[model samples]
Target: MTEQPDSVVNDPNNYKLSYRKLILPVSLISAGAISFAIPPMKELDLSAKIEVAHDRPGKTTLDNYTQYFPAVMVYGLNLAGIKGKHGFKDRTIIYATSQLISAAIVTPAKSLIAEERPDGSNKKSFPSGHAATAFSTAHFMYREYRDNNLLLSLSGYPFAAFTGVYRVLNNKHWMTDVVAGAGVGILSTELAYWLYPKMNTLISGKKKNNKSVVVPYYQSKGVGMSYLLVF
Candidate 1:
């Protein structure tokens, strides 16, 4: 048995159940939802304006690489001696889950809405997948290292924003599509963070004093010792 300290029990960071903490994230989602539903946004001419402003003949190849840059930066930061909120296992799980959630939401929305692309490529361009990927990575980086380095943590958003811009410039998605994708991406990461603790409990029990264990098993002529380490 272990005794919980008062500070640990009362820590708002642990539960994340406060209205103050949720206001910004919820606002992001609500803004996207309201904008997507409203008449002004429905008949918005911003996408055409952008295409007319920056329409070029060449294809945008850089955006494909930039979309995943934020996620790579998180690992780079960890390798460069910057500490994040969670360790390798938790971060991996959260990142993977966030991408999955983003995909699940984006895929069906595209199919159901069937919005036409800016360049008349296809009818499945309501929310930009590149935008979703970029923002998800941005939020993932933000959640991980915000405590250690605020500026570095914030660096991901610019890249994500650039990705959205490129998507519009490339005539792949509209401004509304990018905005909705950003909201979906942010919400996915937020949901992943909220679900992390529960996932940790289900995958492995709470941290223990002796976090390293080696157990041996033998089955007919086969024997092996499994080494388990938790940090």
Candidate 2:
């Protein structure tokens, strides 16, 4: 008779995993919060000016793409039925919360920084909302499906990168703003995941082992032989 597979047990310390996950985000937020609070270092402020000037061509080329990104993300999430899944439901909350927080942080920063845009046109140029939105969506996608497949995991990088590029192309934000926005987005998503256990019913549900088959193949005497086993 085939032996029964040994059952796996969930660790009582699983909640500890949540704390561990919180570390990087908390650190990032701490860094960003501190940096935003301090007066800009002289060299850093100069560098921002140079980068804005150098990035003009890119900003001009990619400006058109910025307007459509949010609409695209909304349509994609709605069509994908992401709202139906527990992980994604938590992700949506995180995304919205992060955006709101970033907006709050950014609005005042922009008003105070009064940093001129690359084109010298607008007053609010610090902390690109487009970059924040992009990073937030990329992070949300990463958290929602990171465990599902390798392909999904790889897809997030391009989206985030494109958003940053678009922001630069539009001359809507300085490089510093984009970096800070990215940090905010990633940190916010992590914070959401850390809080999920407290708010979502799915986290309280029974944990089950998901199984997949492993196959090994060998070639001998011009023929192929294979063996399959459950994992």
Cα lDDT listed for each candidate:
0.69, 0.50
Model 2 over residues 1-231: C-alpha lDDT tens digits? 232222222332422336566565455445534545666743464576676567556335443353224424542654565331233233333444555555555566667876676667876666555555566556656665555544564466576777776665565555666666666666655655554455345433433222221211111111122332223
Question: Among these predicted structures, which one has the highest TM-score?
Answer: 1
> Could you give candidate 1's per-residue lDDT for residues 1-231 as a string of tens digits?
122111222243653645664566566555555655687765564645455566555667788778778888886666565657765556766777777777777777887988888778888776777787788899899888787788889999998998888777777777777887887788778887777666556756545334354433211122345564544
User: Which pairs clash in the backbone of model 1?
Assistant: none
Clashes per candidate (backbone, < 3 Å): 0, 2
* TM-score of each candidate structure, all chains considered together: 0.75, 0.57
Query: What TM-score does candidate 1 reach?
Result: 0.75
Q: Supply the global lDDT for candidate 2.
A: 0.50
Error of 1 at 172 (Å): 0.5
Candidate 1 segments exceeding 4 Å error: 1-12, 15-37, 50-58, 205-231
